[model samples]
Target: MYVTTSGRIHNFGAGPATLPLQVVEECQNALPNLNESGFGLMEISHRSETFQEIIDSAMGRLRRILTIPDEYTVLFLQGGASLQFYMSALNLLRPGDHVDFLVTGAWSQKAMKEANRIGDASPRWDDSENGFKSIPKNGEYSIRNDAMYVHYTSNNTLFGTQYHHLPDSDGKPRVLDASSDIAGVPIDVSAHDLIYAGAQKNLGPSGVTIVILSPWAMKRVGDDLPTMLDYSVHSSKGSLFNTPNTFGIFVLDRVLNWVEENGGLEGSVARNIAKSNLLYEELDRSSFWKPHAKKDSRSVMNVTWRLPNEKLEEKFLQEATIAGLGGLKGHRSVGGIRASLYNGCSIKSVEALVIFMRNFEQANH
Candidate 1:
């Protein structure tokens, strides 16, 4: 086996982001023989008591951290947040029923497209012409009172926009795709009828998606649905309808434990705010950089900005890589630099990035 290095680079990737070093070290120690089970974690059977305990621990910790109400059921499933786009429509909507979507960015637009295949999904309001720079204000959309549910993305990873406050659904059921900023942000769990997140950004890793649903939302799941696509089936079976991602759940368990120990959602949010503020402050202070999203709708988790020109942005990323920074490249849809400060990204890393930014600006200017 190759020996690992002592110091780690500051990672700013959008997804499959950095994980807490403590959680990674704990997983490493347990991988060889989990809980003294006499077998490696990957070798253990999912039905074994060892695996059962792991899943149960993960679920319990997530509930404690999020303060999820007892009436809501949490399921750890395979597909990422992308699957929930259509699954939400299939479960709660029929051919005639309609679902309203707030199209703020690329992910929500994809969700609405998927929902359209299932039912009469329509965009209540779209801000694409403005380059998805900000979220629509309250009462800006013409919501149909008879719609089945309103779908929105809590954070748009591609465009770097976030909703600081959730929309007033007008008593209609709210379906949120919170894949990018779920555990990193504090939320009112009771306010949403259904919420789903892919466990790659802030939670743990990919391959596991957490779906939390209220009792009323579960009741609306369509009958005769395929076993795999049915939320009610997964909830009834306790997210063990099929073989689950045992390793993913194990890592998630450790991550949630870390979150709770560090002060739960509130603590995560505080850390993220500090990191984002540090970077944004430097960006705003310099004329060499230009932020993508509006100040009011900027994402605390992902800060996207452009340099004076593409050549400078390329040079900055190349030099930043040599200086032990990684994943500073922006998304393909929008060309720029993006720094994703997930829960695991430390303040030290953000400070280093800001220092590098200032140096680069000074040298170039």
Candidate 2:
């Protein structure tokens, strides 16, 4: 059996990213028989009281950490944010109902496409002209007051851009896809009508998605929606409408507990800012490296940059991998180096990466 030893490499993958070592260890200890239920976590039934406790604990901790408002219902459901792209449209919009989208990067573009398939989705504004390096100015988008909802991705993982401030929806319900940077930073949950995130990034493992929605948003859900695709159905049943991702939820619960113990959303945001600043400062100090995103729009969670050329980037990736720094390669759609500094990434790891970057630049230049 494979075991995580003290020699674990610093992970920088975007999703399925690194998790707190303490959480992993706790899960390891409980895998055999969770809560002394005589059955392993994977072997237990989802309908059991033990599993209910686990899910409830996960929800409570998430609420405490994020300060989720009392009016919003949190549902831990199957399918990643991709499913939510369509599910949100199905429940909240109908044929000919217009939904405004702010396309910042690949993920938001996909979200718009999905919404378009179900409703009259149109881009309020797109930053494609700038290669998505910066977010659109506040007044740039022409938002329609008649639109049912406005959808946006909080952080663009591919382009390394993030919206520092949310758009003014002008009383329109806002749907936010916060998959990449959910728990890594603080957000006003009440500011959004619907917020969805895939668990793999900052929350936990893959296979589960977290959806937090207000009662106002739930009331707008379309009638005769598919049983599983209906947000109201899952919310009504307390996310126990069907067999959920038991193991994933279990890990997520432990991860949230880790977040609370360390501090909360505010604490996590401070840590993320410090880590990203370290890397950004180092990148700015070196001409050999070029950060992809603009200064104000850069993502605290995913710091993407490029070397002088593709050959240099390839060499850097190879050397970094051998030096125990892995998953530095960026997404294939946008080829470059991306060091994702998720919540689980420690400041020491960022410092080590910055040191490696400086040495690499010096040796090459």
Candidate 3:
């Protein structure tokens, strides 16, 4: 396994992925006595004033970094993006309401299935037959005229595909599950009515999910919704309707602080692009590297590919783990190899990966 002199591995897991060393160190420091308040990071009371300050800072920094509209409401909740898959539909949709989904990958397919529980959810565009290799262009699908909203996943972690442009929603509201590529790529916050992402990938650790909602989305929320699933309830109480993931929120805040200090969203986007380009360059250099996603649909955050055969792929993963290039294995559903380059991943890690890839190719070929 490849180990840095600092004793850290080059992490490339999809979710709960890499984090900035600085953030991790800060969390370590805070764990003993948070803000010198005689409270451990994980033991602090969620209702305490100090903890309140941490959550407030996190929300404010996220808004600034994402350039969220002043009118939009941001909530930090638990249960990850999976819960949001159901809660978003529960809150924004009603019985018999029609919703169109652009099923680019596995996550969107799940999102559509959850939405179908509440309303008529139809796939406006599904790429499953094509192995989810590419995203659709604007005119590639038709949104139902009476659709209540359009739902999509901005990035497909399982398939290494991403939408480079905002999807066409036919002027209807858009809901996005941006679990894998939220802050690592360019996104138009104002364009989406509702957006949810689990913090494990680009933002921080697991357990905390970020939800951003426009005024229209809040306005559209049906009455008498379940308290925990209701956006309005969570927004009204500032996401403190119930006890939250204190440690995760604190870590997330530190991650956002790191992002702000390192040139904010623009810096992350450029770095991610550079990292993916390095891997894609090596992939294109030889037919031995078989990338899963098409060129225009390649994801900057999660890069997936295969070897010439299953045996070689297994050999590659074994050697990769032995070399300390960790978390290079792909999702089990479509196993091959995947390298996730989230916001906290550095260019140095990418460089190491490329060098190792070249060496491996030479030895194996």
Best by lDDT: 3
Tens-digit lDDT string for candidate 3 (332-358): 877899999999889998898898889
Model 1 / residue 155 / CA error / Å: 0.5
Candidate 1 Cα errors over 4 Å, as ranges: 1-5
Among residues 3 or more apart in sequence or in different chains, the pairs in candidate 1 whose N, CA or C atoms overlap within 3 Å are none
Q: For residues 266-325, write the lDDT of model 1, one tens digit per residue.
A: 999999998998998998997789999999999998899998899998999999998888
Q: What's the count of clashing pairs in each model shown?
A: 0, 0, 5
Steric clash count of candidate 2? 0
Residue 362, model 2: Cα distance from true site in angstroms: 1.0
**TM-score, every prediction:** 0.98, 0.97, 0.99
Ranking by lDDT: 3, 1, 2
TM-score of 1: 0.98
> What tens digits encode model 2's per-residue C-alpha lDDT throughout 98-118?
999999998999999999888
lDDT of 2: 0.90
The candidate that wins on TM-score is: 3
